[model samples]
Target chain A: MLKPDLLIVGAGPAGMSAAVVAARAGLSVMVVDEQPTPGGQIWRGIEANAGTARGRALGAPYLSGLATVRAFRESGAVYWPSTRVWQIEPTLRTYVTGPDGTLMIQPSAILIATGAQERPAPFRGWTLPGVMTVGAAQILLKAPGTVPAAPVWIAGCGPLALLYAHQLVRLGGAVAGFLDTRMPAPLAGAARLAAGAVLRSGRELAKGAYWYADLHRRAGRYVRGVVDLQALGTDRVEGVRYRTADGRVEEVETSLLLIHEGVVPELHTARSLGCQTRWHAGQAAYVPVLNEWGESSVPGILVAGDAAGIGGAEAAIQRGRLAALRILSRLGRLPAGQEGAEAACRKALARALAPRAFLDRIFMPRENVFLPDDDTIVCRCEELRVRDLRGALSCSVGANQLKAFTRAGMGPCQGRQCAYTVASLIANVEARPMGDVEPFRVRPPLKPVRLCDVASLAEEAAPP
Target chain B: MFRLLEQGRSGEDAVTIDLDGQPVRARAGETVASVLMREAEAWCRATPVSQARRAPYCMMGVCFDCLMLVEGEGLLRACQTYVRDGMKIRRQIGARHVVPSC
Candidate 1:
């Protein structure tokens, strides 16, 4: 068994930033990530794409990750890429499986920076091939530098979807159409949010405006206030059907359909550790309850980045640095009166998150889209439909109870794909606040591992 | 369903991996999901529960929609697994068979 003074899960912007700080502070840091490379989803393949034309096309924000990744490599922190931490015991004994099978890690403190994932939304024919999230499409462009051969239709709303459509247009790729699903907010409320956005995040708002204009100019067709969206196909996605603002249904033929509402913090690792979480209504996801230092309710466990909330990469980096400072102070490695540095990080984090409320207000997912049609498959892994879940909800009151009654959240994904939808269904039926509806209890062996891998871990534990 | 961009396809070595009974070329750093998506028929596996054809939805490791079988391993996530030369890949048709460790 190997021991590190600080164990950081994920190698994203947050985790990487924290590792650099903690390791520089003389702590033995081990950063583990499931991806094959260092950059997480936001900066996937950043190292390879840094100086290339593709990176330039991705803009300055993406290339900024190269310096962070380079510093992390030279930080004296041990990074174990492709290592999946399936279990983190109550004793903070972490179990991971990688090239050498399973290994146990004992660490003094654990930081979870697992980051955010695209919110999984279910609709008619979503299970069909060729339908994927806008985030997935971005990964393809970033990693393999691939783009769809034919014109692809993009549906849904948010800065990400707009940004991706703009990126594809910049790449000289074809866009069949864009279906914007953002619901209209009240004029007074929207004006208040827009004023704040203009004042606090003018540059970010300018970038978003540029993307919107570019996509609108380039897209073959653009429709706003779209609802009742569904992929129409047999075996694979053949076309898209959506209801426009005027309640008129429109259909467009396309081989590919990319959808996105927004992202939610990935909570499997943190949840399994029994960290306290509360539902964020605007983001429509459960985020861990963390203190100012990024430490969770469970002492010694810290959460940073989007895992704590929907703060983007910039906020995540500052939060990571703040967490590292706190951990160093706890370890007695830092002298007192470091309040200046701490205050700086806090101010930067606040500035980075200033426009979040405005963005959330504008891009909040449509209420109708949250609850799928009865026939739609909500649980992708279990092939369970909304009707199936509704039948179970008659007897079940919460997510865990519904899982037992319908087996919706027991699949390989462990409810990552269906938890949001399942919780929504239960709340709608039980007539309770979404916060009151409990999510599935995340257990160890979070990712599926082979029996042989478990046996190898046991062998490693045995005395020689 | 996908093609590589000329500007971004910089100095990367290409390797051939066996898909079913046929050989397919893939870039050195590309994952199995990326390689598979290049095919016109991009479906990677059939769902174990419904035998419904499925393709990789999330290129990241979260969604298990891209589960495929390698030469010796049980089902592995295609999006997470990098493509290696001569690696025997097969679409998981149904439930994975129980592999005895004894």
Candidate 2:
């Protein structure tokens, strides 16, 4: 087996950008991504979809990924797609399963840019066939150029949902309605944030305005300040019911229900690697703690992109470059006194994240969004409901104990979909902070692996 | 059930797969869940305990609701697995049992 100087875990903006910089600096870099292509979720399938008319119709911001992906491809970095990293040992060794079989790589340094995932928001009938997260719907449109069935009802708050609705409408898909759960309270310091955003990145503000206007133009029934939202269906989603700000209950008949409540850093791999984490109130999730250069508490390992915090794609790219620069300096490839360059990258990252505070304030998920109804399924894997979790919580105080009492996070996902909800529910019941409630322990084979693959691992090992 | 936006716009090669001994039209790069969504009956399987019909919810691999039997691969995620010609897929009825080989 071959060991590389640095191993980049994701192919998103952060990981690819880091690879480009590190490989250009004459360092041996290996980039591994689960997807067959380099683009991670945000830029997924950019290599295959770019320059196509359908891709262009996805809008300008999405097309910007073309240049970064192309640069990574041309950087001479070793690229391995269709590879899943099942485990990363504390000793900086990564175990991955590829087309052939399981392989191990011991890199001198590791960069985990695993990025973000849609925050799980459970509701009545959410497990029904037609209900999916807004991110999932966007993936269908971005990758396969497919749209959900018409009479689609989009619910929840955040920029992603609005952007998806706008893209769907632009792609000639009709949305039946939208349910905005953002509270009616005016965001404080909005003028200041707007000024900062415009001064820093005018193009981003303009793009957001365009998407908003496009969605607004095609809007059918826009319900704001909605509460008690539920997807009503026996077999599949037949309709959605919600209460308006005026306390009026309304129901919209729709075949598809797309829900979003923002995204949080995907922390399973990081937590499994024993990296330090802290609860971020602004993002309403636990984020891996990292230094200015994206280095985690675990030495020789770095965390960047939305994995560190929700700073969007541009900030992720800048953070990736910053981490690469630090790595280059540590490897003695770059000059020692590069404070000026580092400062510039920091400034760019700040500008990129300028609009985040304002956006987070307005789009902060309401309290009810996290606390599911008694009947709502909290754990998608185990089919555990809020009432079930509450029953377990009466006797259990920690997440691990509750997991034992009522198989909440022990399913195929390994707590990916239910960890936050379980922890939040535990916190609510115990009257403790979310941070105090321990997250579920992550085991090897982060994703489910076939037993045959495990048994064939010895035969697939490469000659030393 | 959901359908593609249009024919050529999907930019995917066409392929056919067998779903429970029936032919289903699907694109080469499309997932099994995509094909199931386009069908009249969108559901892929029923839950083991309650026998409740379930379809692909997250579309991504996380939700685990889109499990199906693909070519004797036992239960696999329909959303993650891409379609191929002559692929034999069956609806996952309940709990999956891995039969041991001698």
- What i-RMS does each candidate reach, in Å? 1.6, 2.1
In the range A1-464, model 1's lDDT, one tens digit per residue, is: 88898999999999999999899878999999998889889899998888888888888888899989999999999999999998898888999988766889999999999999998878999989999999999999998898888888999999899888887877868888999898887779878988987898899989988999988999889898897888999889999989977999988888899999899999998889889899888777789999899999888899999998999999999999999998999888864566698888989998899889888888889876669899899989999999998887786567887887778988888889999898888889988888898879996688888887887776788889
lDDT by residue for model 2 (A86-153), tens: 88888888888787677888898999999998888888888887888898888888766788767688
Among the numbered candidates, top DockQ falls to 1
Q: Rate the local accuracy (lDDT) of all candidates.
A: 0.88, 0.84
Q: In every candidate, how many clashes are there? A: 0, 0
- For candidate 1, the C-alpha RMSD (Å) to the true structure equals 1.6
Model 2 residue runs over 4 Å out of place are A335-341, A460-464, B9-13, B100-102
- Which candidate tops TM-score? 1
Model 1 TM-score on a 0 to 1 scale: 0.97
Residue A462, candidate 2: Cα error in Å is: 9.8
Strongest candidate by lDDT: 1
